[model samples]
Target: KTTDILVQAQICAALNRHVIDVTTPNVGLQDWSNSAEYYQQSPCNHYAKFWDQQGISVDQLAYGFPYDDVFEYSSSVHTPSPSRVVVSFGPYTDGGGNDNDEDITGMGGNLSVQFTDSPAGEGFANLIDNDAATKYLTFNSSAWVQFQANNAYSLSSYSITSANDAPQRDPLNWNLQGSNDGVNWTALDVRSGVDFPSRQQKQTFQVAANSAFTYFRFNLTNNSGSILQLAEIELFGEGSSSGFSQTIQAENYSSMSGVQLENGAGAEADQNVGYIDTNDWMAFNSINIPNSGNYTVSYRVASEGSGGELSLDVNGGANVLGYRTVPGTGGWYNWTTVSHTIYIEAGTYNFGIFAQTGGWNLDSWTISLASGASAQSAATAFNSENSMLEIAEISLSPNPAKSQLQIDFTAEHANLTLLNAHGRLMESTSNVPSGSLLSISHLKKGLYFLQVEIDGKVTVKHFIKE
Candidate 1:
C-alpha cells in the first residue's frame, strides 16, 4: 500500500494537475512518505520530509517536488536590492542560502484578517498569504473581509487577483471602506461592474481616500454568479498627507435639500444622497480649516447623465470655494472621484456642497491640505516677529545637511517635529531651544518636512537629508 501511494504521488506531480493529455517521461524523481513509525514531525511538517533523502544532502540536488522549499530548503534569494546577481543553470557553487530574510509583503505591515463568510477549507487567510495558487471562495455573494493592522495606513491603492478557475465567480462590485472603531466605517473607494477577464489576473485600482484607518473592510456586495472567488488581495501605499485631512460622508449631513437617501454599491456608506437637482445643497457644520491655504476638496460622485456640476461654499455661499464638473460614470452607483483645489481661510465654518448642474449622486467628500500648501512658509509666518501669537523667525543653516541640522528660532520654547516625505513622524522634540542641533545621520537620504509649533501657530518647512 505504501508503494502504491508513492506511485500515485509521483503521478500527480508529473501531471502538474492540469494536463488533459500527456506522455510520461521514462525517468523521473520518486515521491515518498513515511508513516508515524519512521517520521517524527507533525503532519503539517511532512512536506519537509521528502527533502531529507535519508541524510543525503539536497544542497547539491534539484528539487524533487514543486513545494520542496516548504521550510526554506530550496534555492531562493530574497533581498530588497541585490548589488549583483549571478545565475548559472548548469552547475553553481552554494553560497549558503540565507532564509531568515523577512517576506517582502511584510513591508506593508502585518494585518490580521477576518471574514464574514467563507468555506471551511477556503479561508480568508489565503487571500493575503501571497500564494496565488490558493484562493478564498464563498457561497454567499454578499461577503465582507476585514483587515486590521497595528497602525493606521493611508492606503493609496489596492489590488485583487482572480482565482484560477470559475471566472463567473469573480466579484462584480465592491467597496473598500476604512474605519478606526471597525463599526463606524467610511467609504474610501467604490467600484461597480468590475470584471476579471482572465484567470489569476490582477487588477489594481487607486483608493480615492486621504484619511488613514487602522481597519479596512473589503465589502463584496455583488458578483456574476451566486458565489465569489478571489486568489489574492494586495494593499499598496501608506501614510496620510501632512496637515489637515477630513472625509465626511455625504449622507451624514446637517441639512439637505431636494435629495433622498438610498442604498448604494461599493465601499461607501449604505446610503447615498441622490435625486439632486439645481439649487439642491447639503451643509456640514463646524468644518474646521486648520491653517488652510489652498485646500483640495475631492468629491466622490456618480451620474448617468451628461452634465453634473457642484460648488463648495462656506455658510450658504457666503464664500464660494470652487466648482467641479462631475463626469458621467455610466451608472448612479459607478462612483468616481473629482477634485477642486481652492483657497480657503483658517477658520471653522459651516461648509456646503451645492449642486450647480445636478443629476449626480454624492457618496462622500474629502478636504485635505494641498501639497506645498500645508502652511505659509517659515519666512512668511515670521513676517510679524512682534506678534506673540505667531511662530518666531526661524532659520536652518546648511539646507542640505549630511549629518546634523541646526534649527534657529526666536521663541523661548517651541515644538519641533520631523516627518518623512510620506508624512510619517520620525522624531519630535518639545520645548526645543533656539539654535538646537538635531542629528539626522540615521535618516535615509531623502526629503523631509519640519513643523514648528509656537503658541498656537504652526509653521512648515522642507529640508534635505543627504
Candidate 2:
C-alpha cells in the first residue's frame, strides 16, 4: 500500500478465547516468510482493519489478526457462507478497479496500439501491462490505441495519465470511440487542445454508452511535438467485475513470439495447439467470479523430459494463485489433467500463467466454482503424482519413463495393472514376464500406479508417466 506495513497473527487453542497475538513484518505462505529477507506487498496493508472497525483497541489487538485471523482459505465455501459476494467487473485496464495498476497485457489479447518505438519497454505493450513506471510512446505525432473486451461491457468513464517526464509528449488532441469491431468505430468522446502541465498527471473524463460495446479506441493526433506518449489508461463501467467463467487455450496465450506452438486435439482444449517456452507466460483478462470463494483450476498438460513447475500470477503481480509441478507423460503427445484450488476475491482480475523454469507443455486450463465440490477434491489437489508407494524394492526402469517401461520383479507369475492419478485403471497386463519392456507410449503425463499380485504378496508402486 502507501506505507510499509506487515503483521503476523497467532491464535492459541490453549489461550483464553478473547486473547490474540500480533507481530510485525508479514510471514505467511503467499506473503513473506520468517526466513525471507524481502517484505510482502499486498493490496491491503491492514486486513486487520476489521478489528479496528469493531472498536478493538491497539493494545488489546496485539500483533494484529492478519489475514488468517479472520479470513479462512479453502477450496470450498460451504464450510462457512461468505458474507459478501463480488458483484461487478471492469475492464482489466488502468483506472479499472480490477488490475490495480499491474500490467498484464503480455499474457494474452485485449490490447492493440499504433506506436512502440519511443523507449525499450515503453510501448503499446507496456501501456496496458499495468506498470505506471513504463509508458506507451510513438514516434508519429498521430496514433490509435485499441482495447478489446472479450465480453460485452457497459461504459462509464476512463482516465489517462501522462508520462512521468517530458510533458510535451502528452496527447494534445484525442478522440474516444466504441465499436463492435476495430474496423468500424463510433465516436464517444473527443478533446481538442488539451494539456497536462504536470508529468504523470491524470485527467479523467466521464461518458455513457448507449449500448454494450466490445471495442474501445483512443485516437491521439496532433500532440505537442513529433511524438505521442502516455503512462497509463483506465476504463470503468457497470460491467460485473467478477463471478464469470473463462477458458484459456495454451496455443492462444500472449508471450514472446519465440514460444513454440504445436498441433493438438481441440476436444477439451479450445485451441488446436499447445505452447512451450521458458519464462514466457500466458494471461487471461477480465476473469469474473460470481461470488467470493475458492476456485478449482484444472490444467491439461504434457511433458517429455523431467517436468517443470507452473505458477499462477494474478494481474502480472506476485500474487501467486498456486503452484503445480508437471509430470512426464509417455510422450509429448500424451496428455493428462491435474487440478488445484485457490482462493480469490470475487472481482475482475487478469490471471496469468508463468513458466517458473520452463520445459512444460500446456493444452488448456479452466476455472470452476468449488463451493459445491467435495472436500476430498480439495485435499487431493495438494497431493503430487507418484508421491505415495507401498512397495519400494521393485525396480522400475526409466523412472520418468517415456514411450516404454520395464518392470523387474522376482516372484511367481503375477497380475499387473496400471492406474491413473484418480485410481482408475488405464492399462492391465498379466502373466509376469520379468524384466519385460512394456509399450506405454499411449499414457498421458501424470502419476500412475502399478499393482502386482504374486503368490500371497501384493506390491503397489507409484510411478510418473512422463
Candidate 3:
C-alpha cells in the first residue's frame, strides 16, 4: 500500500497534478488510530519529507477541496483601547493599625483609605494587598472601594480574592456599580450570600454589560461578621475602541448534524468538532460586532480524509462573505489555519461556517479587526505598477461605483481581470483598450481586485462594488 501511494504521488507531481485524498498516514508516518487523539497540531508537518525527496517547493502545490459535504449550522465581536483611571479613597477615615503605609503601591500608587481603626495589623489597603498575614478591616457597613476608569469600558467578568486570615471578616455581599460621572451610578453586577472557604483563594463572577462606564463602585454590604475585608479585586474587560479577536470553538456549535465533538484530542480549547460528511452543518449565533471595520476571520482546520472547503455567510444568506480551501495535512490530528479579510459593518450578525464540502475537522476560529484598516484599505490587495496604478495616472470614477465603472488608462490597451478579495478570478478580459467601460453591477458589493496585465507584467487596483 505504501509503495503504491508513493508511486502515485510521484506520477502526480511529474504531471503537475496534486492529490487531495492522500496524506502522511497513507504513507505510514504516524500509526493511524481510530481512538481519540490530539487534533490541534498543524496537519502538514510531514509534507516536507515528500517535498525534500522530490526536490520541489511546497508553495507550487495546489488543492481541489471536496465540497460535497453540505450541512446546516448556526454565531459577536468587541474591540478595546487604552484606559485611564482616577483614584479616590476615604470618607469615615481610619489608618491606625499595625502598618498601612507599606501597601501604598498596591493599587498602582492610587489613593487608599478606610473607616474606623483595624485591631492591630489589618488596614483597608491590605484588603487588596494579597496577604493572609495582612488584612483590611472596616466596622462600618457603608464602606466601599471605587475606581473611576477615564476611558470608559464594559466588564465581562470580575473576581475577588479572600484574605488568608479570619473567614469571619471576609466580604460576603457587594454591589458593582457603573457611572458616567461619579454621582449617578447604575448597577452593573451584584453579588449576595457569596462565601470563600479557603484564604488567599480567588473567586470569579460573570456579568454582562455593553454600556461604556467611567466609574466602578464595589459596595461592601455584609460579611461573615460585622466587619468586612478582602484580599484582591480584578476586573476583566476592555475599552470601547480596543479591537479584539473572538474565537468560536468548533465543538461548541449550537446545533450540529453529522458531526461529533472529539474530546481529549490535545485541543488547547477543549474538544474539536469532526465526523463531517455530506450535508453536515454547524451553527453559532449572537456574535458581538462592537465596531464597523475590516475584520480578519481565521479558522483552525484539520483532516486526514479528502481535503475540503468551507464558506462563511451571515444570517443564512446564500451570498458568501468569504470562502477558503483546506488542503490535506498528514493526519487527522494535524492542523492548519485558513483566513480571509473582509469588511463588515458594526452589528451583531449570526455567523455560520457551512461545509460546502466535508472531510475536515475544525478546532476553532477567530475574527479580528486590525487597527487603521478602514473600508478603503480593506479593498483587497491591488497595484497597477508604473504610473498606471497611481491615483492621478489612472482614474476610476464614481468610487463605490454603482453601475458601470470607467477606467481611463494612459496606455492604449491593458488586460483586465476581476478577482475577489481572496485573489480568485471572477472575470477576465484580454487586451482592453486605454479608455474602456466595465459592467460591475452584477458583482457583489464588496472589495474586488482588478488586475491590469500589460506586457506580461501585472498591475492591480482595488475598487468597491456598490
lDDT agreement with native, every candidate:
0.64, 0.57, 0.58
Higher-ranked by TM-score: 1 or 3: 3
Q: Could you estimate the TM-score for every candidate? A: 0.33, 0.34, 0.35
lDDT of 2: 0.57
lDDT head-to-head 1 vs 2, winner = 1
**Residues 241-359, model 2: lDDT tens digits:** 33345667776665433466666544543343345666777777777764444466888887777767777879784687766667777656678887755656556788888777677
Between candidates 1 and 2, which one is better according to TM-score?
A: 2
Model 1 lDDT-worst window of ten: 95-104
Q: How many residue pairs clash in each candidate?
A: 2, 23, 32
TM-score of 3: 0.35
Query: Which candidate achieves the best lDDT against the true structure?
Result: 1
Q: Per-residue lDDT of 1-466 in model 1, one digit per residue for the tens?
A: 9888656654543343222122455344322321112223223223333333221222322355564443334446579987998754421112121221111122223344444366776777677654455689887767787765433457767778888788888888898888866689998988999888877777878766467665778878546668877888766644334557899999999998888899987676488899999999999999877542456689989998875878888978887766677889998998999975566556789999999888999999999865443233323333323343445788886876768999888888676656554443444455578888888765544456787777647777667654
Report the C-alpha lDDT of model 3 over 374-460, residue by residue, as the tens digit: 223324333333345443356676665758888887777675656554343454555577768888755543456676655445567
Report the lDDT of model 3 for residue 378. 24
